[model samples]
Target: MADEVQHLTRAFSGLGGLGVDEPAMVSALARWRGQPEKRSGFRKGFPGFFSSHGEMERCEEEYMLRLAAEFARLKNLVVLWAMHPWERDARLAHHVLHQHHPAAIVVEVACTRSADELLGARRAYQALYHHSLEEDVAYRARDKPYCNLLVGLVSAYRYEGPRVNEEAARAEAEALGAAVKSAAGGKLLAENGDVVRILSTRSKPHLVETLRRYKEIHGRRLEEDLSGRGREETTTLLLEAVLCLTAPAKYFSQVMEVALREGADEHEKDALTRVAVTRSEHDMDEIRAAYEEQFGAKLEDAIAARAHGHYRDALLSLVMGAHHHHQ
Candidate 1:
């Protein structure tokens, strides 16, 4: 572990000079891909090896100035991968909160993480930014429905147990159905307190049961009902939250498909890297299966087609398991 940390430190410091050694950095990152403990150790030891503050940020800024735009994506991926997952997510949430239509990213972080993971991210957010995740989210999402929904989600500490009350699930499903029915041609479901409460509070299994009951009771998926109202921002955010919380693999697979599609813009393509980096260790296999089941082609082959050079290599290394070799 000590040798590996030293090797990573050398590889990172070597990123500077006349030109960046992109493969060296990729190789170093690949070594730690599925090894979360080693990655954590490296993050802890990194500062001891380098006197600089924000070494990853400095590397990223240098790459931006010295390398082409495509290389910038690779650098971003490295920076994200190298951080502790908690800090990585907190930073991701912070970065996206400033972007246009950031609800999807916020919803992704708030919904997909496990209870402990979400709590860790919130704690990291407070430690890193000196403010609460919910506080920042509420302030940034100052509009109605979005502010309400996002704040509720970030503030949630959902029950992770297997217990599901059938009566409660059915009643909530009925409330959701009624909310959607009443919301037609007027304010969407995001404005409904019951919708927000049920989504933000229920356990994953409970929500799955509720949504299943919703389909049984309503004769269609809840997303279909929401989509029928058109793609208004609040409705879309609500839809995103539902899909993210209930069907994360499917949600991530859809995100990858759009990101790898032809003529995808930079913002769209960014999702490819984010999903690949974040999910690779956790559930890449499930996401890959979901992608193949949905798109009729392998997720890896699609990534190879869209991404190029070192950027492509890094992404593939992540999507495929990274080799354990160093240098």
Candidate 2:
């Protein structure tokens, strides 16, 4: 870690103290990675130029290490920039599945639930990773209860029309309520399939109507009732997925609220990146409005208060419509 810090500090400073820009340094590192032989002489001579002071003797080794780390870091940034939004989301989802981190999976599914978006993401996954997204999820996501729910969500091709059958919504709402009630024990219930199918296959417009009917019929919000039962991981994901589908703007606003809060950690930074990159082109404007309405703080102001460096500038620009990639 100390070595990494030293390398990052110098790499951030300039390439070998030549005062080169980050872009230039990144370019040079790309070239070096492609042609390491070209740098063999410099790498060999690095030890000879150590400072006369013993402290300076360590500089050459550190410099080389820093160069390598910076090269990898910049390369990653390049890949991130080059990726389409769907590809980025696929990679993020693939990582989440493999690592067993399911917190953001529902949000990801919500963002891509529309027919065109989900199809594009699946294609992007195949193009980038040479494998189907569903296949990967089935293989990597070992936790059975939530895995089926996630797979069902991604695989669903819901009707996109706004025309919802009110009678059906009311009836299905009751069915869902009964399904939740049937899961009386803490153990997994067969009725969970009903919950997953209802949540996954329903259209956003239809689902919203169903949730409204659910609340009216049960005299409680769907999410609250789900939580009140305290079922399992699958149920938890179901609630989050339902909320994101029904009110994405408010859901994302709460995501940003937690991300920009004081004492936030790297997880917050990552969450901010996911939402900003994915939604910028989709519902960013709605998210921004929701952010201000819910938190009483402008999205840009909140991001500016918490972020810094080029990252901060990039985020601010995305939020304020200075970039095409942002929503």
| Model 1 lDDT, residue 239, Cα | 88
Clashing pairs in 2: 280-326, 280-327
- Give candidate 2 misplaced runs (Cα > 4 Å): 1-82, 110-112, 187-191, 229-232, 322-327
Error of 1 at 288 (Å): 0.5
Writing each residue's lDDT as its tens digit, candidate 1 over 8-73 gives 566454333112346655776787788887765665665433234553412245443534545577
Question: How many clashes in each candidate?
Answer: 0, 2
The candidate maximizing TM-score is 1
Q: Give the Å shift of residue 102 in candidate 1.
A: 2.2
